[model samples]
Target: MADSDQSSTDSPVDSREDSIQDSKLDKFSEDEETLITMMFNLVGERWSLIAGRIPGRTAEEIKKYWTSKYSSSE
Candidate 1:
């Protein structure tokens, strides 16, 4: 019973560590993708313009979403 309790506590911490490592790995994988890099390079800095063109995408709305997203990830 004591062993099971210890394992349970460790399990969540291990899972969290794995998720953090996975996120870093995913970022590295994204860096290797040429097409995605190109699109991000072209449109990332100009969220407003992209938002304007895409239907249902408003500049302010996109800005807020991206801001929250990038902020949380960092």
Candidate 2:
């Protein structure tokens, strides 16, 4: 009973975070791939600099996206 109550309260916070991240990513999608490409080319893959231009996305997320996109497939 106590465990379930704690889980219920904690779940909403995690759900909210997921929704926030999704919304942020959605904003990036609106600008198209070209904008991101230009930023990356000029900024030199520096997430901190890129994040300034794109609101809501963090530096880490920027790096992660770049890695996943350019990573070599085996």
Candidate 3:
């Protein structure tokens, strides 16, 4: 019963997370790269701050983007 309860609550949350990621991927604009870079320089990798500056991106998505685009380890 407890497992069923947990599963019922979790599915919507998982779907919402997936949709947010989809929206970010679909709507990412070329201008966002410049904005993200400038904000990173000012804030130094604080993802929520960067996401607030750029509409339509969650902190998680922005973190992924920044790492993928700018990671020195790559």
Candidate 4:
């Protein structure tokens, strides 16, 4: 039925949104934070490379976290 087709189409999008939300909620473990800091020092804003060093972390998330935690407010 059309309803079933619509639900199927919506399922993947819903799951993707759920994953995004989950990632946003996920906190960086201490090891992850330390690794990110060390990697940033080594790589200097090459976020994708930094992300490669940290498991389950996206470049965007690492970049956002670093900027919020480390960037100067002034």
Q: Report the C-alpha displacement of residue 1, candidate 2, in angstroms.
A: 7.0
Question: Which is the winner by TM-score between candidate 3 and candidate 4?
Answer: 4
lDDT of 1 by residue, 18-70 (tens): 78754543443333334333544787757666555545545554455445445
lDDT score, candidate 2: 0.73
TM-score for all models, in order of appearance = 0.37, 0.60, 0.63, 0.67
lDDT (0-100) at residue 72 of candidate 1?
59
Judged by lDDT relative to the true structure, which candidate is superior, 3 or 4?
Answer: 4
- Cα RMSD for candidates in order: 9.8, 3.6, 4.3, 3.2
**Candidate 1 stretches greater than 4 Å from native:** 1-40, 72-74
Q: What is the TM-score of candidate 2?
A: 0.60
Error of model 1, residue 44, in angstroms: 3.6
Q: Which stretches of candidate 2 lie over 4 Å from their true place?
A: 1-4, 15-27, 30-32
Error of 3 at 73 (Å): 2.1
- Best-to-worst ranking by lDDT: 4, 3, 2, 1
Ranking by TM-score: 4, 3, 2, 1
Backbone clashes, candidate 1: 0
**Which digits, one per residue and each the tens of the lDDT, describe model 4 over residues 35-56?**
9989888879999999998877
Return the lDDT, model 4, position 15.
94
**Model 2 lDDT at residue 67:** 73
Candidate 3 lDDT trough over 10 residues, lowest sum: 20-29
User: Model 4 segments beyond 4 Å from truth?
Assistant: 1-26
Off-target runs (Cα >4 Å) in candidate 3 are 1-27
